[model samples]
Target: MRPYWCVAVAAGVLLVSACGAAGSGAAGSGGPVKLAFVYATSSQNPFQEMAFGAKAAAADIGGVDLALSAPTGINGPQEVTQFLSTIHNSKDGVALETLTPDLFVRPLNQAADLNVPVVAVDTAPPAGTKVGLFIGNSNTELGKALGEEFVKQVPADATGEVVLGNDIPGLGLLQQRLDGMRSVIKAKRPGLTISGPFDSGSEPTSNFNNWNDIVKAHANAIAYLGVGAQDAVSLALIQKNTGRKFLAGSCDPDTSALQAVKDGYVFALASPEHWLKGYVALRLLAERAKSGKALPTGWWNTGSLVVNSANIDQIIARQHDEGSRKAAFKAETDRQLANPSGYLRPLAEAN
Candidate 1:
């Protein structure tokens, strides 16, 4: 068994490290390489899926001790504190999701000063941050795909409103999703008017209520699209409760959202491949730690999934449990290792 110390902090942080070894030299001596994968928040679906992938990577690539954590809620300062503390402790390497890039400038630059390999996941790093690479879905493309699904479901000549809700109005990723969907709808269905990318709070109950209000107000909308994880299930719930026929689409394939797609309530789901991002981020760090390989510089597009009636069953089967999900993506991970250039792209072209 790998000798290590795993500490669980009350601040919702989990830090793991190999005992009695300098992280930089650990891999050289075949000792455990410690890593920290921190997300935006704890107990959320997307982040939990990411954690699953990170754990799988740590296990599959022996001698890797991975620690993961995030804030209990949407607290930027708390997340920053976790990031800074992890940076100070995790000497092998660190990977993180910087939703609010501003909060990470100091810690990211500090990591750079310490010669630690840093990879940003789920969000691209800001201009001044010292992130080696980014790994996540192309948010704009995901939105365009969701919009295409909406367009396919609507009538050819239908001219009506398409209501959109954003759980976090100012978030760059959500805004990009809204913009992408808007671009698609305008190009294909100019006759269809787009409504507000309203601030539907990220909290589940409020998210549902906000969508409920939007639907009740625009009962005749051609389609309702959500740019947040909660949007899929909320819109589906609203549709099922009121028997509304408005075509509904949203992002992420959470359990309820997948069921929504399978039940014919939601038109389609845009899956950002949360697990792949986590797995790839941790795997990259492990490779660098063990083999002295340089982490690729640029955006590594983990890609996305458009879950609909056609392939919902396969998606559902893979997500049944952590083991099933890891097993499902093993070949893809191998493919990534076999050809890195295929997925890695310049930072500017990440969109």
Candidate 2:
């Protein structure tokens, strides 16, 4: 995501005025433990899913005063400000979403000093950040899966380039995804050349324009792969509008991206299952708040889902509402609780 300077006053207004708090009364006579979910942006499908999952966890746990805070767009400083405010407000715990983990190192470490548990969501925290747990997909593995799908669709002897785009050019997670895909394409299809991990802008319009230009410039590319949801939507639309017969696939999902897969315009989607990241992060924090226990320190693998024609309908059905999502994720949640080790990987293995 592109970074923008969010005004300090604007950050305050969002934290104090716009934050949505949900709860089900008090826990342990503390008059409802205050927990906050802080993300980069609220005006996107993935973040909305995350908020729904966090709110669902609060509702399920009961007595959690869960507050959701985010800027309307990608703003790292705003997220850091909001997170520090959440901690200073005597919040019981926090679930933080950040692609730039270094921005939060000091604040997260301070939260740990105050005995406030913090869980990193969507992206893992960097070393010395002191977050108790990370709840997200194994990004490198997810990228490999997407790569495998692309390889499966294209012939082994294909000679043209497979252009790749990284929506957020410098982010570690996106880079890992690009690297993972590169490794597979290089190893499996020696005849095919991988073009780029280009700076495909994070915003929709720019992302589309970047892909459109790339597609036109490389007319005979065998495939156009992206590592972000916006890329998926843009590539699909470009494929339809230009009538290009190139293969297209990407990481994550949205209504338009999923529909592209369903319509056969796009080949598949590698969903990080964003909702599960929020759900697991909040649940772990809530348990820590209620029981006065330290959170499990490691990577909580919320896992990934590869959506193709075979399961597109099922994946679409699961996106209807919070109830639908919970029902769909129940089995995995049960496994998380029953066999935590199966899902908890070393932080080093998160990428």
Candidate 3:
């Protein structure tokens, strides 16, 4: 289990690690409720941080046996199979991230039949799915936040281009991010031509290779933006190495993204709060295990952060402290649940 905090976000791996203290108690006469976390993304820094949050929740909240798993790398078919295996393998409940919507429908329906409570983490269930809850963010709003930054930087009369690097078309969640970003950029700066939501091949090397061509073509684009974590880093490297000048921004964070922001190579970084996503997902599932009640389904936006040069260092430092991270996550979840007008909403089960 990779500790998301203290390692990946801090630019290197830690010498030692801390898994949350084991939980205690029993959900019923069947003994402790078995809980599993099945994520779609690889063991990337962001996902690791997410798992760290899940571990924290497992320790802090008693009476659940928690287990976490994901594919070895960025393999969707494996993830889909593992997702199916996880829910059906006698677990009491599950927190999952779907790689694709349709592929998991039958498994989710099976889960509902088996009385397995499921809460979606990182992405929302497709329409007509019986998943318990959705703990994520409004990608469109997140894009708007970035758009506001772009508006602040661009001159009203100056016409140029803004390029978006989005990878992995299979995941609709990322697509929403791209969609939101496109809307915001279009609405804010009509003169500034927004370019391709180009295929940023998932890994940094692939992203760099793909974006390298785009950079070669658009030598004078106004700004560069990415919907993936590595895309931000790749953009920073390309701009720095090739002397291609542009304001760089991105959708998520990793050590590379943080470094780029601190060095002023990246103007802003939108954090998806993966750690909080896992924590909240597991917490909601664990709660269901004990109470025998399904989650109030609907959207529970875990939230996002737009980090700039001024706050990059501070945010990275804050992310390293597991205790502080968990405390902040708890506070955020409490806030989302308490705020009636906020993104968090309730969905009654369809009768």
Candidate 4:
């Protein structure tokens, strides 16, 4: 995902002018609790699946009304507006996919004032902000996992160019993933000459065009690493057409990424358990709403894994099996509730 900035919250009186809070309402005595979820961007495949899990949880676990909302695109200001509007109307608890942490802290604190539980998903409260619960992955670890894959696939004494790509320059989100890849590569295979961690947009043409130019220039590049799903898929297509034998490492696995992995074009893709993310996050918020509990403090690493020829087929098959997926999710959710500390740990604990 392409992110804009990770703005830090100022240490002062929490401002309220920007985040709208004209009037707030709550459930009546012995009444159904109303809950909500807001995303920064529209329901892409991954996020759409997340909303599905949340709604399914609401159906199974009753006494709560689930309302989901989000802006069409990456409109940070509009997302804040929608979030405020959502919380204003539906009052109880909320799980939000925070685009800009700075824009959210004020309103989130406002929700806290109402005694409404707020859980952060996709992104989290910056350091020192007293947000009790955060649910997401250690993307840096995911990057490192992919780097390990690169070292395993590429020879130790290999000498060639490495073409890497990213969408935005200063996006705090992608930057972490990029940094993770760079750190791993530098540590494991310092002999490789990495080139063009270039600007790659989401559109297929842009990815293809940018990588096409880079691959043409550096025909000796041994492998290609991309920050997002599109980057690796585009390279996969290019490699197929050109019949080049470069190793490809991708960040996420969309259908194309999976197909590339199934074929020989892409070697490996690192992933944060996205399905687990949605189901577990919703379970956390729902537990907060039904019971008077809050999410645990510190980062909840969803865990990361590498997918290659050995596991891609099984993984792709599981993605289609909703029954099995939900069952696994339920088991994980039950385990988390039984012992959240066991399921998650501090960021410092991860490799």
**Highest lDDT: which candidate?**
1
Model 4 C-alpha lDDT per residue in residues 309-331, reported as the tens digit of each score: 99998877756655555765676
Q: Candidate 2, which ten residues in sequence have the lowest lDDT sum?
A: 12-21
- Candidate 3 lDDT (Cα, whole model)? 0.71
- Per-residue lDDT tens digits for candidate 2, residues 62-180, read 66667778877788888888788888664688888975688888988889888777888988887886675788887888889998888899778878888999988889988888888
Clashes of each: 0, 0, 2, 0
lDDT tens digits by residue: candidate 3, 1-351: 332222222211111122333333335544556677777665566777777777776665655566677765676577777767767753667887755666777778878888778888776776667875777766776777777776777777668888877777656767777777788777767788888887877776788999888777777887878877788888899878977668888877688788888888888888887887888777777766766655765777777888887687778777767777776577776775466256666643210
The best candidate in terms of TM-score = 1
Candidate 4: where are CA atoms >4 Å away? 1-31, 127-129, 203-209, 321-324, 346-351
Candidate 3: which stretches are off by over 4 Å? Answer: 1-23, 337-343, 346-351
Q: In candidate 2, list every pair of residues with a backbone clash.
A: none
Indicate the TM-score of model 4: 0.82
| Candidate order (TM-score) | 1, 2, 3, 4
The per-residue C-alpha lDDT of model 2 at residue 102 equals 80
Q: How high is the CA lDDT of each candidate model? A: 0.83, 0.80, 0.71, 0.68
